[model samples]
Target: MAALTTDSAKTDPLIRITDLTFIYPGSVKPVLRQLNLDFHQGERVGIMAPNGSGKTTLFYLLMGLLKPDSGTIEIFGKPVRSEKEFENIRKRIGMLFQDSDDQLFSPTVLEDVAFGPLNLGKKPAEAKLIARDTLNQLGLEGFENRVTHKLSGGEKRLVSLATVLAMEPEVLLLDEPSNGLDEETKTRLITHLSDLDLSYMIISHDHDFLYELAQSNYTMKNGQLEPMERMHIHYHSHPHTSHRH
Candidate 1:
């Protein structure tokens, strides 16, 4: 299938994948086949697919965690083919892992959130301040010194997001962000993400969440992305009537 381009493709995209193909070692078939995508700045894109459809693999390829067997990947208008090139890309694009436990490792919430900024060369004090502000932005102001492992699932998810936001990334790649959240927590997450200005691409199975957050939606089929219409829900009011006996 031909890859679909966004309407704003005339402008340079933040990330571009052209004819990308990948195959696992010793596998008889390619997991991804001639995939093409263009992600522009300030766009909220959602991707939905069944398990083992190469959705997460696509994300890994974008971040240079996995190399493509064929085709090219360009970020910020430059071709990326090496880890050294991907280092800068990683700084600009933050990824929120599907599992919060895989993301947070520091003993304290502040430390986990500040780790990215520190690696980016910010002073310890400055990194802490960034962490605090990120937490505050997420309505987690008092969680600075909380024990990382002791936090609830929702809190950990928010803190994991805080760790990514602390680096001030231009784009975010969120994997199943609403996976384990309660309805209330999911609502909170939706509100918080709606208020952010950054561009993001979310991979999720929750159509409701995607409809709420994504401006553009796509479905992954046979290792390719095809544009899809957003799902909409309508409401109706019913009136009760008394029956005479």
Candidate 2:
């Protein structure tokens, strides 16, 4: 297993949000209020929030998909405020949406996975190679020619993740990544995620999944984020049995 990175080095944050506030159009209540966060390199951050608690809204604001009513968002030490500014940032921050259908639209699995690299200006062959490698990384070998819409819900979710990973982003924002997955698929997802070196913020309600991978965890409530106490988990492995407590 890869060693989890700690914030002991005192380096600048990879991404920062300060005094951020946002309210949806025509809505009086702000979904997010004075939100602040700092994400460091190689960190796995977990966010737990109930439905409609503004977790997804926070992600959109970070991606510049939704404009903040007030405050600032900085990525890679640069302030991002406009769509033009976010274009390059988007290349560095890959997001996996809550719904697989929202992310995958290509006819074949390979095309869907390769789309990001292709759009990033890689040649078709190079993009295809990246797509294949990403799929294999997620234990999806030989799924290249599979019909995108015909895949099972779990398969589609993994393929969606492959699409994001193909971009080789510096940061990842995963929303509800384990929503429709069974226990076996979820464990597979955790294993794959644990192997990656990239920094990511995962929004999940599954405590077990978050506990498995997140180095730091937070709870979102009333438009604010509060750090959660880290739970000490002990892992035990035996023949045909694996569990954590």
Candidate 3:
């Protein structure tokens, strides 16, 4: 896929990517090609695309999981030019991966949620307090000692988000948050996400979830990002519509 660029508003943008391109270690071609986009603070942006449309790749780039070949990625007005800069920016960005199993691998749910803060040098007790509070906020009170591996699919997904929330990141990156959730759980997830104050970028195939949680939309096709039209229907009406713009 060839890379492309689009113009962003002249106002201050929270993220800036200029001519970014990246190819996997052993792959012959780059997954993202000269991609450029700017996201503003406090915006709930939905990234919609078919499978392998570079949606996940874009998230990885923003999260510092993967480095770009020859472009600049700036976060919060700071340029990410090296691993150290990326590490610093990572502390301000929370991420929920596509697979719950990939994220929740600790012995207990509390341990998993505390991992981020612990790595940042907080005391064990303080980290536990943060984790417990986050879980309580998500209606998972009194489940701190629960074993992570024993959780159900939906439970694991919620636990994953709880872990990220404990970090109190300024930017939230969620990939396929509704993948394995039941209808009730999905509704609760939407409610929780809508109440968060952080800026967020989400990659999802479920249009209903996007409509309820996202104020703006973008799509990736052949390694390029195209801005999608803003949708303005009452999302609470049908609760299951997948209509796109």
Per-residue alpha-carbon lDDT of model 2 for 1-245, expressed as tens digits? 13323442357789889989999999999999998898888889999878998999999999989999999998898899999999999999999999999899999999999999999999999999999999998899999999999999999999999999999998999999999899988988899888988999999988788988888998887788988877522222334445535
Candidate 3: worst-modelled 10 consecutive residues by lDDT: 1-10
Q: Clashing pairs in model 1?
A: none
lDDT of 1 by residue, 1-245 (tens): 12334445557899989999999889978889999998888999999888999999999999999999999999999999999999999999999999999999999999999999999999999999999999999999899999999999999999999999999999999999999999889989999999999999999988668878999988888888988865421111334363211
What value of lDDT does candidate 1 attain over all alpha carbons? Answer: 0.91
C-alpha lDDT values of all predictions: 0.91, 0.89, 0.86
Which of 1 and 3 is the better model by lDDT?
1
Instruction: Summarize candidate 3's per-residue lDDT along 78-159 as a digit string, tens digits.
Output: 7787778888888889889999999998999999999999998999999999999999999999779999999988889999
lDDT of 2 at 213: 84
Task: List the pairs of residues colliding in candidate 3.
Answer: 3-33
Best model per lDDT: 1
Q: What is the Cα-based lDDT of residue 158 in candidate 1? A: 93
